[model samples]
Target: MNFDNLKNIYQFAEHFQKEEYWQNLFQHQSSNPLPITNSPSIKNSNIFPVCDMYQKNNYFYIDMELPGMDSNKIQVNLLDNNIIEVKGYYRSLQENCAYYLKERQNLQFIKQIALPNRVEERNLQFSYKNGIYTIYFRQN
Candidate 1:
């Protein structure tokens, strides 16, 4: 090929290489957006008082501290792309009982978590005990 053709071919190959590199990088780094606590259930403003998440062998465990809440009041949902949402409410005492000082939070709260990897939706499980909500999922 002539010198001009050779140069043109080289330039096209260089451009293709740059595009491929960027595509690969994006594919590797792109991940689902993490869930945010923007939605608050008015009935329960003190939702998700404390939350923690960890991963083990083929499993993801989410533990949340939800004091003064009954088992029936809390709702847990798993969304597409491995997002977990916890929604619940806490009841307030009707009568004003005399107390020296009360500093505990009692309101509705909503917490959302983004999973590290896709999980089996059907295999999800939840347990509530001692005012703690624990959610378990099998990794996909």
Candidate 2:
């Protein structure tokens, strides 16, 4: 191919790589953008909360975003001394009536992570701040 053709191909690829093209291509066409919390009953669609885990310096951390959730609704448990389980329910509706049962399905999320090593369970601490759960552990 001539240099002109090569230049044109490069330009096409460069344009395709732009953020706007990809964003428009992947944009959901639905008028109502459904979040994971909106449709827990969707078949084959996993709505589990996303998490980030890592070890830094003297602490191992597992963080998950849980916006609009009450801290009291969340439960954390350490299983088998090595596996940690985080469970919670998030509700968007507040009316307490059986009539809404069919219309409202609370968003429940659970995430479990296995520790790389035994941790000081007695000293392990966690905090929920700024719409995130942060579990901290120091290696035993």
Number of the predicted model whose lDDT against the real structure is largest: 2
Top candidate (TM-score): 1
RMSD of each: 20.0, 12.8
Model 1 alpha-carbon drift over 4 Å, by segment = 1-47, 92-96
After TM-score superposition, the amount by which residue 99's alpha carbon in candidate 1 deviates from its true location, in angstroms, is 2.8
> How well is each residue in 43-136 modelled by candidate 2, as lDDT tens digits?
2123246678888897888888777788878888888958888887767676755563464346766666778887656867889999887888
Question: For candidate 1, what's the RMSD?
Answer: 20.0
Would you give me the overall lDDT of model 2? Answer: 0.68
lDDT (Cα, tens digit) per residue for candidate 1, span 27-139: 64447333233333323332235567788897788888776678787887878777777777666554658866765645666766778887766788988888787888877
Q: What is the lDDT of candidate 1?
A: 0.66
Cα deviation at 24, candidate 2, in Å, is 22
The 0-to-1 C-alpha lDDT of every candidate, in the order given, reads 0.66, 0.68
